[model samples]
Target: MKHCGKGVFLRPMSCDIKGVENLSVGDGTLIPKGCTFYCTRAELRIGKKVIFGPKPTIITGDHRIDIVGKHIIDVTDAEKLPDQDAPVVIEDGCWIGANVTILKGVTIGKGSVIAAGAVVTRSCDPYSIIGGIPAKLIKMRFTPEQIKEHEKILNER
Candidate 1:
């Protein structure tokens, strides 16, 4: 891990992380068992107070499949395949549900809840309740009035 703030906890023995130095976790984030961060080409920033359900996967890159006349696994410098790499940012207070797959360059906004088995392919807004493969906005988690109150409470904490 590149940086970890207060109260960050992960079951490292049960997790499969490729780029440990590219993983930075903020205060009070609780990452559960069997989670994966495959960030060999880019970094991951998990914000404060985020919670993860079982077996979530965050990837910052994908294998190059466009190499002419060459298989993906046979690409030269396979570890540093730089063509499709980008950083992933999960903002503060997100609740990532079980079996979620968040792809590279996606920024999950503050206080969002990602539903179980969702595959997030794009960025989402704050307080969103997102679900489904190539996840879409199911709803906002709170009324605008309530969200203001929520932020106030979070700031106090």
Candidate 2:
């Protein structure tokens, strides 16, 4: 689906995007095929110049497994578990690799790289590189000097 100067390449088997009103994909963004974007009761805001690899899942729903597991005998309610419903914000200039799963209430900071197949459970810091199952910070995108220069330019603006 094309929207607002952005190109979204959605696969035929892509998961349904709920809460379309609350989801925003910015300009010059690309969402590859076979990805799942769930915007359930929370906003999903994607900034400009973002790229999503194939089969990526951005989920905005987290449940209490301990409480739900005990008394939720109903099979239907099992999948309908309650979530925190906080928004998932992916800021500008991000490259999200294939098969990544971003959980609820997480903010992926600007200019960061999320490696392929990483499961992001918490928030990420800007200009950082994250990988692995829980998404550890591997390194910063810029050196200290470069970061200072960048910040100086921003301060002037």
Candidate 3:
């Protein structure tokens, strides 16, 4: 937890944040134990009041495999390989369950809930409840009217 906002709670041994310069955790975020954040050569922006369960892994970069008859590690030239580095954004008030893996270029919208052991590879809508290996949208947390009402209440504060 190199860069974090106010009142952010990070339990001991909870996070292994690579590339501390590229990571930004917002206010009131709670990161429990065994969480890993890999932000090598990419940016990870987590918004306010996000809650992360145990052992969650957020990866912001991957090795590109485009060469034939050559081991991926053998290819030393970075320019020859495909670009796998991308930013990962989690909007305000998301709850990421235990052992969840969020891949690169994913933006989780506000108030979304990611189920345990889910592998998230894409963006989610606001207030979505997503689950499963590929992390499909199970349902919205609230109806449109309810969301509007909640937003109104938040704005009043």
Candidate 4:
């Protein structure tokens, strides 16, 4: 593990992470090649046993889009529009597929599977199978009985 000032780069797999001080990753998380996380003004929390495929991008900030004809990059520091920034939370045991882009203020629930090339822009229930652009819920990972049992166990904790 290489520690660069305030940022801690976990060994074995490298990632491009902005605002590393606002990021926290759980143990046994496997971040494969070409994974990027951009966190600004908010904390990005990733839980344990999470697996990320190649070229997954998790961003927590979006530029404003109120000014007409003016590019977002050009309007810097001047009062134009408010930026949308929120924390991203990825719960434990998630299998995020290749080239998935997770946007701001999204909370991926535990034991969920996100399909390849999906764009996730919202929160999800636990054990969900999400896919496609904007990332709709395809199905639940567990059966009704299994979900009940899981919820029972979680309630005890």
TM-score of each: 0.93, 0.77, 0.90, 0.81
lDDT at residue 143 of model 3 (Cα atoms): 99
Please identify model 2 stretches exceeding 4 Å from their true place: 1-15, 64-83, 148-157
CA deviation > 4 Å runs, candidate 4: 1-14, 68-70, 77-83, 148-157
Poorest stretch of ten by lDDT in candidate 4: 1-10
lDDT of 2 by residue, 44-68 (tens): 8888788887888887865544564
Q: Model 2, poorest ten-residue lDDT window?
A: 1-10
36 Cα displacement, candidate 4 (Å)? 1.3
Ranking by lDDT: 1, 3, 4, 2
lDDT of 4 by residue, 4-96 (tens): 223222543467888888878777777776788898676788887788888889998877767788887876544433347788999988999
In order, how many clashes per candidate? 0, 0, 0, 0
Candidate 4, lDDT over the whole model? 0.82
Best by lDDT: 1
Provide the lDDT at 130 for model 3: 98
Per-residue lDDT tens digits for candidate 3, residues 1-157, read 4468999987745567778789899999998878888886789999999998889999988875777887878766454433578899999999999999999999999999999999999999999999998989999999999999998998898
TM-score of 4: 0.81
**Model 1 off-target regions past 4 Å?**
77-83
Candidate 3: minimum summed lDDT over ten consecutive residues — where? Answer: 74-83
Order of the predicted models by TM-score, top scorer first: 1, 3, 4, 2
